[model samples]
Target: MTTPLEGLATIVGPGNMLTDPTDMAPYLIEERGLYRSSAQAVVRPGSTAEVAAVVQICAEAKIAMVPQGGRTGLCGGAVPAGLDRAIVIATERMDRIRVLDPVDFTMTVEAGCVLASLQAAADEAGCLFPLSLAAEGSCRIGGNIATNAGGTNVLRYGSTRDLVLGLEIVLPDGRVWNGLKSLRKDNTGYALNQLFIGSEGTLGIVTAAVLKLYPRPTERQTALIGLPDSQAALTLLGQARRASGDAVTACELMSRLALDLAVRHIPGLRDPLGTPSPWVLLLELSSSRPGGLREALESVLSQALEDGTAQDAVLAESGTQRQALWRLRESIPEAQKHEGGSIKHDISVSTSRVPELIERASAAVADALPGARPVAFGHIGDGNIHFNVSQPEGADKNAFLDEWPRLNRVVHDIVMGMGGSISAEHGIGRLKAAELARIKPDLDIELMRRIKTAFDPDGLMNPGAVLIP
Candidate 1:
């Protein structure tokens, strides 16, 4: 009798199937190292047909499957839940750029293509694939689509769902649905692609996609502005947008603590101001046509400073300067790691209510656990903030992490009260599954469950991700 592992080997050959603990170590650990995944084997399928075959074998043998790509997800969505009869289907081997149509402004790429590679390909073709994140260098496109990722550019180019035109997915029962059309406007009945875009592989396995592209920006301006508070930062954001005629591409907010962490941990990164303020905004504006963008940005910052909305500001004068500023913004999460245990929240509220949300949430957490550090920052242009809380200095790491549930309630309660989403860019993987159920309306949860049942009745596709079984 052929075992399931041997059967999977037959589909992708022996070298592609990894059963050794050492060989599978990389796949078993989540990005944040918060969870340990267990799998019978890690199978790498080089093509869609091979993926289908592997899925078919797993389905027939009643083995649960965990679909993974690059394994850089912060939410533990790609990690398995230590199931005895589960296997990980990694898409790293399926990387390929099938097509790049500059005329059509679309690129057809396999799921495993690294996001940074896609951006380079777009740049080479005089186009821009604007879905970018800190982990773009290692994160795969499949995972981006699975989570409907929102990055700094989401303020200009929408989230991953908006950039994607179509997707090619392998269903739970080994059926392939090739809806890989590059059309912009398709009025055909029900839009099935939307279902799997942010499903976190619960509905099906994403193999490839048709992504929308835009014209490359010929000119850009970046500014790091210090504000008195979140409200002042919000006011400065409005000033930037109005001054630049709404050409602002990114507006990120960083608390003083977040900036301090970056400066302390990341070498060569200095505070942009002589005296740090309570809050800072990283503002960027771009234009395909090169004409007075810097001057316009300077004018906005000048007026903001005079009006008391901005305390201090520095605009990037060169490409190197712009990248350096961005590095400071991107290094917040990594720097937090050196500060001991951290509790992260990716929540979003209305644009106007962002200031209040930050204030209330920070106060609530401080009251709950005295001396806890609040490092709130992220894409304020779209109202999404990474409201992360660092453990108090000298506290036990495990004990701080153990308070995750209690902290989640305190933060999520305020988010729900303000009509904000609990999980903004990060999908509801195993981390927030219970919180999702607790906060969401019963009817909404029932609808999601019904949809999951319709697509994966056996619940064989990513059993414990997104929707709880």
Candidate 2:
């Protein structure tokens, strides 16, 4: 028998409940179209009280709940699958910037606020909330906190966990745990906010958060460099960091093939160097106190080039030029998608071991899939590599995707052998649950389960998500 969704809808209002298949289509599928499942209904809660109430009602009726934000997650974390008795509680209607304090250097915002908008609000006040991702325009603050996002700026600012000061969460029993404080120093007991930051909505529903901010960067410089390979790139990175001190904000790496895909698939993306190389690095340096950071950064790059660590270089001549370079980096994923299907891996190792990791893992993948083209790129400075493989030209996508499991095993084995992580910035949603179960030690899984049972014994909050049943 289908439980009456009408009763719950009455509390929030008829307009908030979406039961029609067409109306709930967007929420059912994940971003990459990897996971798709139907829901009993989709609910939009406008306030924290409404969220709590929905949780309470769901608990009473024993209906599972999935908390969804902007639905831009690469993982199937937000998608509802094999659960017909569940309703997606989207925080879309709760989009609001609650408060901003320039003096305290913190911004308290509702979970539904878009990341780009939050950054804009802070920028308007002459401050910066440095949590940035490719999906920043569409992804919500709640999801960012839930995943503990790490982006290009992680080398300088750290992850989303570091940016959060406090959080307001709605517990499984429909009670609100208000910890939304904007204080810089609070050494009180166990810091509860950290637990929910990367919990993926398995522990509680994060309704709002107090985020840290910093003084805006006054000057910025960006450059593109050609390196022999990952080792040369690493050497160049170390040199740049030593020369510029803390000014090297980002150090992203790319392969020649990856750049070619961007140039061919994405419109108006031109190679600034007007030449191709086997490997490249996109380095950006910024300083709050500066007349110009470009000269300092270019001098460092010049030294690297002369030292043979960097073979060729192109410094951004203007702000427009800077965005142009970044555009190629940002368009890599989409460009790859347009070209062909790929097997994606977001793995991380120590910054010093990145070159070795890439070499070993890439060779292993190549051996496993004979003609697969490796398209590895990402924040090398922070050791997070989006190691993906595009299908060979005019190859069958089904055949390429068929090697997903074997490909993942080969890469993950190397990552684990190096004391690294399979999922770096991205959390273990439904996509990596099997890998998490296999690679994660038995003791670690047991401890995580114990904590989950202690917090939510019924297994109601985002059931069958991180933990494999």
Best by TM-score: 1
Residue lDDT tens for model 1, 292-395: 77888989888888988889999888999999999999999999999999999999999889999999999999999998998999998899999999999999
lDDT of 2 by residue, 362-437 (tens): 8997788777888989999999999998887789998888888889999999999999999898888888889999
- The CA lDDT of each predicted structure is 0.92, 0.89
Model 1 segments more than 4 A misplaced: none
Colliding residue pairs in candidate 2: none
State the weakest 10-residue window (summed lDDT) of model 1: 233-242
Compared with the true structure, model 2 gives a TM-score of 0.98
Off by over 4 Å in 2: 1-4
Judge candidate 2 at residue 442 and give its lDDT: 98
The candidate that wins on lDDT is 1
Clashes of 1: 0
